[model samples]
Target: MEHRVVLVTGGSSGIGKSIGIYLKSKGFKVYGTTRRLDSHPNFTDFELLELDVRNPESIGFAIARLMEREGRLDVLINNAGIGITGPIEETPHSEILKAFDTNFNGPIHMSKAVLPHMRRQEKGLIINITSIAGYMGLPYRGFYSASKGALELVTEALRMEVKGFGVNITNLAPGDFATNIASGRYHAPILSDSPYKEPYGNTLKMMNEHVDSGKDPMLVAQMVFKIINTKNPKVHYKVGEFMQKFSLFLKKILPDKVYEKLLMNHYKL
Candidate 1:
């Protein structure tokens, strides 16, 4: 009858927020982290921790505080991330670094911080929020896709590495969910006036439109809950509509050139 202790990063809004609330409703002792404390009002009935996933010190401090208070860490959802839209060539070095820091390195830092506690307990779950873009690359979202791809790889390696310790790892690769993740997309400074602007202009617009009309965020939260509770959890959970199915199909059935053509046509590239 013990309640599970769950920590969700970037839980102030979007999929993370929904997931946090859903977990809370399931009787979990949920702790949500956000970089902006002002936005904490959106998340009620859950402990709020101020954390910037990009900062190792912030991650370490938050984990330490949680461990000190609760004495055990049952689940860690690395959900903090940022998206960048536009051509890869037009993305500034600094912006790319920022994307990687948040999307890729952040989870790595959090996982490292939580490992000791989970290792000690010999039982825990780590759910990493990846994207469908991780499986199938999208136009004007190269950097974002790359970051998620890195996360997918990390999730795989960690899954195997932690199995010996009885710690489970799951990568939640949700397709276009109705999250504000699209609105949260950052444009690189170089992309604003770069030569590649004209070429990728329409593609960017289409990308935004697709994201703006994405699936419900709650679907992702439900899937996450399922993954956590399942006896034999999948390493990767793909959700959403055409994107999820298409991504998996391309990986398994389509020829490289055929998939490339379809992707180009789909994105108007």
Candidate 2:
């Protein structure tokens, strides 16, 4: 059998790197993309291609390069994302658009680029690394949630649209994981005298603590490998701590007010 070819965006570090390396260890030909190939972190086994998910031409170029080398791309992981931390009202409109462009539009662009190639092969998988926040809005991370939420809906629709073509798409909504996501987060300017300062400060601190204690990125990589090997994979998967994963179930079953209150309590809003 030919070695399966896989492409992972934002593979320079953290979850993307782990996924790329893990898949390679499983005997797949893995290619990871970073915006700057010269500065990419060390990953001895897999190939690293320069790609900027926010740029359509870059995405196509990287994919074409991989196809030239491998002939056929078996899987594409839309794992590149950015986070903005701030109250919705305080965040600049431009910042919100930037976040959405990277988190939501980036995946859409990559999927669009890969779909035709996958269709020609009549077999392929696109795994989107969304966030658990995609299922529910987060306090300081409103736009982040919104972006992932939008992508989540797209995944559902794409799965239905591509099922006939032997193309599988799914969203992996992960909880906080130990990664470099925090380093790239955009902090909304919060004035000391602002009304939301205290709560926002507390919430931001708590969010970081939760992230600091998050599960290893390799755990998520393991899950992705499982999904790849499964003949029939689900459309949505939650990869995180038990309670965090269970919260989505609660959100569906609990009354609106009840769920809202629980969320407020969780964030100390």
Best by TM-score: 2
TM-score of predicted structure 1: 0.94
Q: Please, what are the lDDT tens digits per residue for candidate 2 over residues 79-175?
A: 9999898887788999999999999999999999999999999999999999999998888888999999999998999999999999999999899
Q: How does model 2 fare in lDDT?
A: 0.91
Per-residue lDDT of candidate 1, residues 137-169 (tens digit): 777788899999999998999899889999999
Error of 2 at 80 (Å): 0.3
C-alpha lDDT values of all predictions: 0.86, 0.91
Give the Cα RMSD of candidate 2.
1.1
- Give TM per candidate: 0.94, 0.97
